[model samples]
Target: MSAVIRLLLRRLGISVIVLIGVSMLIFAIARVIPGDPARIALGPNAKAEQIASLRAQMHLDESLPVQYGHFLADLSRGDLGISLYTNRPVTKDIAQFLPATLELVFCAGIIMIMLGLPLGILAARYRGRWPDHLIRVLSLVTVSAPGFVWAVILMLLFAFYLPLFPIAGRLNDSFDIARVTGFLTIDTLLAGDFAAFTDALHHLVLPAIALSLSGIGQAARLTRANMVETYNKPYIEMAQAYGFFPSRIARIYAFKPSLIPSLTIIGLDFAAMLGNAFLVEAVFAWPGLSRYGVAVILRKDLNAIMGTVLIIAITFLIVNIIVDLLIAFLNPRIRHSARGSA
Candidate 1:
C-alpha cells in the first residue's frame, strides 16, 4: 500500500478503538448515575405496573453484562435504541438534531480560521511593535473569557441594544423554507429564497462569533508563538540576507511552517466547539443536539445520551484524522519518511 493509505488505515484502526472505549465508558457512566431511566420517563404519576413493564421492555431488568451484550448486538445492526424522552428512534432524533449543531460549528470554524489566522500573521510580522502588543492584549482578553460570556455580551450589544441581528433562534418566524439539508442557510439557498438566506446568515453571525472567540484567541496566540520561533531559523535568516522584502520572507518562508503546528491545535479547538457550543446554543435558543443532549441528560435518557456521545466522539475522531492527514501533507519530513518506508 502507499504510505498515505497505510497512515489512513492506522488512523482508522486507532479511531475505532477510541470510539469503542468511549462508548463503553459513556454507557457505564450513564447507567451509574442516580435515578431509574424508566421511572423518569414514565414520570411521577405513572403506576407501578407501568414502570415495571417499561423497565422490562427496555431490558433494564437484565444484568449489566447482558445489557451490554444486547447494546453491542443492536449497535452491530445500526440500532441506537428508542429514546425515552423523544419516544422515537435514537437515530431519528440524532438525524433531526445533529445537523443544526454541525451547521453552527461549521460557521464557527470559518470564523476561527478567517479571524484567527490573519491576526496571528499580523502579530508575528510585527513582533515587539505596538501592533503586536495590541494584538497580544486583545487575544489575552478574549482567551480569558468563556464562550457563554461572549455569547451574552454579544447578544446584549448587537441583538438587544443595536438590534442589528436577531436576538435568538436560527431563523425568523416568518420564512417557511423547505428543509432539504436541515441547514437553514443551505436549505434557504437551495430553495432560491435569497431573502431567507440573508435572514439566516444574520441569525448565524452572533452565535458563530460567540462560539469562535476563544478558538480565535488561542489560534492567534499559538500561531504567533510558532511564527516568532520560525523567524530565527536559518532559512528565514537566509531569505532576509538575500534581501527579500520583509513581507515576502514572512509570508513565504515563515508562515507555512508556523501554520503546520498551529493547525493541529486549531483543529482540536474546532472540534471542541462541538461540545462547548452547548452553552452558546442554549443562550441563542438554537434547536441543536446540544439542547437535546441537555434534555436527555436531565431525564437520564440512556439510549439518547449514548447515541449523542457516540456521534460527538465520531466527529471528534474524524476531525483529528483530517488534521493528521493535513499535517502530514504540509510537513515534507513526514511525507518523505512515509514514502521511503513504503
Candidate 2:
C-alpha cells in the first residue's frame, strides 16, 4: 500500500510489458529477415528432400503467425528454440558463451567504478585548475575512442610490441583448472590454484581495462559535472563554514549526492558494454557471446540471434531497474514514503 511499494510494482509491470513487446518485435524481425533458416542449416549442398525435412523440423512450413505463437509458447517455458547455425538449443548456446561476456563486463565495470569516480571528484573539486583541465581533456579523448580501437592499440602496445601480456584468448595452455563455472578466474580459485588464478587475472587485466576506458571517461565527465553543481549548493557552503574537512565535505556531502544521477547513466553504459563486448571479444579472440552473436548473425541464425538480442535487452532493462531502485533509495522523497508507511 506504500507509495514506494506502488512505485516498484508500477516499474516492474512496465518492465514486463516492455519485455513482452521486445520479444514479439524480435520474433517478427527474425522471421522477416531475407534468408532461409532451413537452407542455411542444411548448408549450400543440401538435397531437396533434406531441405524439405529440415524446413519441416524447423516448423518453417507453418504459417508466420502460428510459428510466432509457437515461439512465444516455447519462450514461456524458458526455451528459445534451437540455433540453426550450431544445431544446439538456443538457451544452451547462450549459456555456453554468455558467462564469458559477463565476466568481461563485470571486470570492466569494476575498473570503471574504481577509476572513474575518484578522478571525477578530484577534477570537480579542483575546477579551473590544471588538474581539472587535464582530466577534462583525458575524459574527452577516452569518450571519443571506440572500445575496438582501444583493444587494438592495447594489443599492439602490450602484446606485440612490449610482449607484456598474451595476445588473445581467456587463458594460457598451462592452466589446469577445472571448467566448473566456465569462468577461468573463478574456476581457478575454486580449484585452489592461486598460480592459475594469478595467471587468469593477468590475462583479464588488459581486456577489462580496454572495455572499461570509454565507460570510465563517460562516468567521470558525468560525475564531475554533477559534483561541480553539488559543490556549489548551500549545504556544501554550510559544511565548509562549519570547518568540515574539505576532503570529508567533498566526499560525504558533495560526491555522494552527485553520484545518484551518475550511477544511473553509468549503469546504462555498463549494459551497453554487453553489445560492445563483441568487438572486444573478436579482437581478443575471447569466446564470449559477442563473438557468438557476430557469427550467428552472419550465418543468419534466427534462434541464436533472437536469444542473444533478448538477453541483451533483458540485461539493459534489468540495469535500468536497478538504477531506479538505487535512486529511489538515495532520494529522500521515495525513501521517506516507505518509512512513513512503516
- C-alpha lDDT (0 to 100) for residue 78 of candidate 2: 95
- Cα lDDT tens digits for candidate 1, 51-85: 99999988999988898888999999999999999
Q: What residue runs in model 2 are displaced by over 4 Å at the alpha carbon?
A: 1-5, 339-342
Question: lDDT of all the models against the reference?
Answer: 0.93, 0.87
Which one wins on TM-score?
Answer: 1
**lDDT (10s digit) by residue, model 2, range 1-342:** 366677788888998899888978887887888888778778799999999997887778899889888888888899998887787899999888988888999999889988899889989989889989999999999999989899999999999999999899888888777778878889999999998888888889888989999999999999999999998899999999999998898777999899888988899899989877889988999889987898888888878988999898888888888888888878877777655444
Candidate 1 clash figure, as a count? 0
Flag clash pairs in model 2.
none
Q: List the residue pairs that clash in candidate 1.
A: none
TM-score of 1: 0.97
lDDT of 2: 0.87
Q: Point out the worst 10-residue segment of candidate 1 by lDDT.
A: 333-342
The prediction achieving the highest lDDT against the true structure is 1
